[model samples]
Target: MTIEHAVPADQAADLVRQLYRAFLARDPGDGEVAVHIANMQHDGAMAAVSDIIYSQEALSVRAHAEPARPSLPEGMLAISRADIAEVVAYALEAARHDAPSAYEVELRVDDVGRGTPLAVVLRDALQPPQLPQESVEDDASINRTIEIMYRMALGRMPGPADLENWRGAAGNGGRLSNVVFGIGESAEAKLIRGAFDVVPGIKVQLAFEIVLGRGAAAAEVDHFRRMVDKQGSDISPLVWQLFADEARRRLLPPQHANDPHLAYIFGSRGAVTLADWRTGKKAVAKTAIKHDVLGFESVVRLRPAEDCVVSILTSLYRGGAFIRSFLENMTSQTIFRTHCELIIIDANSPENERAVIEEFCRDFPNIVYKRMDARVGIYEAWNIAAEMAKGRYLTNANVDDIRRNDSFEIQAALLDTLDFVDVAYQDVLYCFEPRLPFEEIAKRDFRSDLPVVSRYNLMEFNSPHNAPMWRAALHRDVGPFNQSLQSAADFEFWLRCRAAGKIFYKVNEAHAAYFVNPDGMSTRPDTRGAVEAYAVSRELYRKIVSPMLVISDEEFLARVDEIDAAPLREGRRYDIVQSALLALGTRREGVVA
Candidate 1:
């Protein structure tokens, strides 16, 4: 077999990312198909499998293009049929070297059955191969099994083995936070958790909730796509209608059906006023525990100063309908009742929007509108709001969102802990303004799989649910949102919490309404340049990268992946993460020190 060493380990690691991304971005040929390599050569290092998928994503990513590896970019997939086996060996070499590396391997039948390649194998023979990640959340599926302990109390449940096939279908969330409802065959009651929390695919949660069984998953998807095509509307609406129709069909038939054992899966997507589940009703039994929201757990009030919120309100270039609803909902939350404040940065908004806000101020006296004439972005606007807040905590509200009545109550319960979270929020419903509903996104639990930008614990801060209520003091120690950073000032402030050694918690309740982009819904991390000042971030990075010198090659690869994600584009989770890892690896300054 010919040995090739054209690419360095780091670049090879990138290739691995692209490959893996391709796998995820597209549908597998069949569930049975596994992209096997010379696992025997690597001494059973199946870890290369992950590298292949990740590299595929990088190669497939393009400018202004839908992400997915449809056709390989130059050299990205130009693997010769012959080098396949060698690529597998290189994977082993990289693994043995304790670095993140990969190869475009092609294994011949004879090589797979025969002797091991020498020299390279002998050199690193003593080294132990790195294993797959063993994060705290690994036992998600098992943990979920425990959540339904009552079922087990009634019967003998084996373990993760019982859901092996299911475990394979939904990856991360299914594996960790895995829930097995006793619906139909294994029906459980009205226990709904955010399905999105379990998987990363835009629609994986849909797949997990809709059970035609894995075998029928593909057919069902095709059928839904066809319905959308016939409806002559965009995918997002089609997705919503499909869910609504399904909700009506399965969970709520026009007339009730015999589904006492039916496992109900709803979301925190739309606002859910949970209350007692009864028929005119008497109390239920201890055999089953019940939960429903009669009111909201959190309230998101747009407390922009007259200078800020007003400016945004009056900017009124195109989305006027959005503005009207925003104002209407402002005074409606059940918690605020009589009074609520509005903070605006004076010079921040367009003149006309400011005019409208001033008009609203007159209409409602409790509508306290404070303004800073100086031009500032979101962070400062929020600081202004916080300074003017009469309420104990501040929710730097999104301009487009409105809160349901009980919103504040649930969040208050969760945030009252000794360690207050930087912010707290639940998945909101994706609907137009006014009567918008919180959809399935609500029931999701983000404590696990928390993204890097939102993961904070002293020395670093993460932006939690966007519309969370924050203690005004956090702004004091965390400091005002840095004007240096434009869009990311709030995010950077969160990073500061980590610097100060603090952590954010989740309420597992959806409190507010957020308008999702019509095209699709997803968030982007801020690029270093987008921040008004990269100097501080860079300083943080520098301190981070230095001590990281001692980290192993594999860790270095992971760190690099995080840094490359530095672009503040949509899906920039990768960059922020790499930067953080670099910081962690290098922080010879142990106190964030």
Candidate 2:
């Protein structure tokens, strides 16, 4: 076929600009456009196109395109000058080849001396007589194959275990390409592909996924895209810091945990050993570590420790969606720093709660983060956090729930002053969305009504508030919350406390906010699961209180029915409960009302 030649300078410039954008993901500078235009006029369009595409810049861009090495801080290069030169030279040589050649070109550290030019080293390495006919599975070839797979799939170098595992797989008749595909197809590796996302929000979400094992919240996505637009900051450092934080938390798997390229990430971030981490001694190194590793620039500064007074226990499961709001509620509290400590027990949550939690932990000193290796029931997580509580008073904090800014202060003050009250339960403001401020939500709809929850009202239903502050000694008195119950554990515990003569006082104000989420355990579309869980809890409660009860099981349940049928006292309303019932009824009728 005959080729048409470019004639006009404008056409040539347009072609060059398109090539720059297509190959380099950027517009060509004025000077670059002029040079390429001149080249095209003199050498023709095809030659110009070849030169632009085969240029060192284009080659480097393509070589590092997928899973781009996360940006480094302070313009620090991920590799040494010599290593970078070698890589560029290798890429240049590989791209220059128009067709397959008999000679194989490769560069090894042992082939070049210090200060030797990369061109000279490659020239020597490419010599057919000097090149060794190494088998594809040889040590050098396998190492190279492993490195290529890791760089492509994980955006980092393979660790010792990674190398060993891949080598074993290759030796066991596994093809090197298959190993590459295997690594590339893994869930972890899939997250690393965020570098290629054109949408900033998708990129941010992918970064969160890789670093935190969960997608980014909507607010986080918006915040990061703004950073890219206003500040012109690269998201790589954010992703890198996330990785560093994950490593600091020891949340990474063994392969990544032991990666030598990522070793500096842990070293700089004040990472502690497993034993120290378990004992709540994270962030031992307070100062920022300035040393640059392959993927990280500098370590994040961590907040100093705070004195514990009120232990806020949060059990996280599928709570990734609520992390931002939950942390805001806790940190915004007036006594958050002075009197409250948040102990988060993540029961192997399926979402990326750890990343969000650790990010907040850097600024909030009272956060205690712990991860469970396997999924556990909600009550089990609460029990775990309760035992880990260090404050004088402890309160159960659900990940999806929020309270007023002075909620902690109010609850703590009640417990601190009222020596007669062993447990203080406050009225709750119920809302559909916890993201909105409770005060704002109350203007449109509100629910705050809990009659004195004595042993009498307790038989009808668990009237004790969901988020209650009680003396830490009460845990010893009533023992930990019943781990056996799901939706009704708190109820059984309240019954236990009442039977043990523990006084429960109801605070006048609605300080706590309950988010009636449709997907929540108690508020899901199906009520059968919660009802069955309550059934189990009711049986257990009856057994625990039977010895001290004056009524039989039938009479107790009958009294509960009576309490349900009783009219509300003056100025008392269960707006939250009524709303829940309305939603439940609507769902049963196949309507969203």
Candidate 3:
């Protein structure tokens, strides 16, 4: 038993290409082929081929080879058991006798032999005596059949390009069966068929599972069935409607008046104290302040106190032109120059950029510049700036983003009127291009509708980060932003505020323009940030929310897992929080029995 020698180096490329096509159902790219060929020369042909076959891409293709199908048979007329039983009985009677009454047909199908073709039997029993057959090979008949096949397989009519492609494929001596089979085997066809194959009952159950993480109640199932019957054979729309309704229902804050959890968490009725361990005392701690913070200078000062402070964190040397724009926006603010103080926290910017900051500070009396000895991350810079703030209220200002002229005034006014509102946030207008005129960009408003902030809503969704103003006391009460978190520092702080029983008020007007930079930290996909945000949310849930609800630690953690598994967008960390809150509410009725 001698092992075969490895294939020659030149032929290994061809073998690699062949394996790629065999396993992945596509030709290998030039680069892929070259890499694999090199591997084959170093290892062996068999080893190279095995590696390609077991690769993630190849395994994904293989997994999709046999797409999932509905358990129900394709082209079945009746879905309900009674209807199916009647059709079966009629088919059996037709197979047994040449001419049978409807009553006899219903009675005889149960007695038919096991191996008979029910389709043929049903066709004979259902149809009248056959007339002279028309030629279905004609253009009109073929076109009509093609359209029907497209609908049955894809759940919709084919597009012009797809229709033409199919027509060309079938034009070369094609039969109707060949066209139908080709369409039926497609991935789109399989998915559509599978979706429709699910009975109305199962669809209702799936809707409940997807939205609320539970099975539908008997009443809910009955209601969905009624909806399905009204909509006829197309139950897909009904399923979507059910899912939407359930999502809205779950998102609506539970009747908080009687919710013991809300009372415990928010201390709405003074049911819990700030010193209680259950009221997030364990989770709230001051982030360790870095003593390495060396360079500190107030380049400008104003004697008459300001009501608000605009904290801007920037690495002026790295931020480039955006830093200038940030300074211009701060100076141009309608009320900020008079009513607010601008604090620029520079993380040891270059000498040239430091000169630029000094020039701005020299020109503006209200603008103050502070440089750190060492470069601290954004979260730390935020914390340091907050500590240096002199105003009664503080709001974060971004280098590349713009705030409306009256943003500070409006938020300050709102806070003044509402003493209970610890923080005030406004809607933001998102602009893709930073160069765009603020007036033109301000037309688009991204409103934060979570008006009343609670642990439940705050955990579920995050309000706009740079668009909010908080009372200085709230910051003092909540401590500083968690320096440990890289991306979700703002979110963690917001959670802390909510945990500390601080109420957030929503100012309906668009007060800021959030510029969307492809390279920006928040917009780009950060796996670590997402994972960290998730962990933060879970800990918040355990320390703040779980204590309020009648849920065990094990059950609460399990609910967090289910929420984490949901198909949530990575950037929308609040959605994950909301989902966890929804899950906790759903399980509050009973444990996972």
Against the unseen true structure, what C-alpha lDDT does each candidate score? 0.39, 0.58, 0.55
Number of the top lDDT candidate: 2
Error of 2 at 547 (Å): 9.7
Model 2 TM-score, all chains together: 0.40
Off by over 4 Å in 3: 1-317, 443-454, 525-527, 546-593
Query: What is the Cα-based lDDT of residue 228 in candidate 2?
Result: 28
Worst lDDT window (10 residues) for model 2? 259-268
Candidates by lDDT, descending order: 2, 3, 1
**Tens-place lDDT digits, model 2, residues 1-593:** 01113347765665566456545657789999999777766654544665776677876787686312211111112222323233333333443433221112212332333445433443343333344554566877988867865764566898899889888988897777677677767787767655453444445555665666643433344344432221112354346545655564464354332321111111022322323322332333334322121113323211233568789888888888889888988899877877678999888888888898889999987899999999998888888888888888888888788787777776776666667988888666555544876555444324455677664456444556478888889888878876865676776677678778788888776667776666777655443433444454434433333321222223333444443432322111233334445655665688543
- On the 0 to 100 scale, the lDDT of residue 402 in model 2 is 74
Clashing pairs in 2: none
**lDDT (tens digit, per residue) of candidate 1 on 125-195:** 22354577865444464445443432322233445655554455345444332333332123322222222
Q: Write the per-residue lDDT of candidate 3 for residues 1-593, one digit (tens) a residue.
A: 00112445555555555445445667778898888767755643433554675578866765576311112111222112222233343233333323243223323333233333334344444444467664446656656556766764566787777777777666777766688688767888777656556445555555555544543433345334433432223444444444544554457674332321121212122332223323342454534322111113422222344354444333232566576677777777756667777777777765445666677887787777777787777788777777877777778777777876666666666666577878887656556556555665544322233435555656545763656888888766778888887778888888777667778877656667776655566655432455567556544543344321222223434555764443432212346557666766677656655
Q: Report the lDDT of model 1 for residue 165.
A: 49
Shift in Å, residue 175, candidate 1 = 58
Q: Estimate each model's TM-score.
A: 0.40, 0.40, 0.43
Evaluation by TM-score, superior candidate among 1 and 2: 2
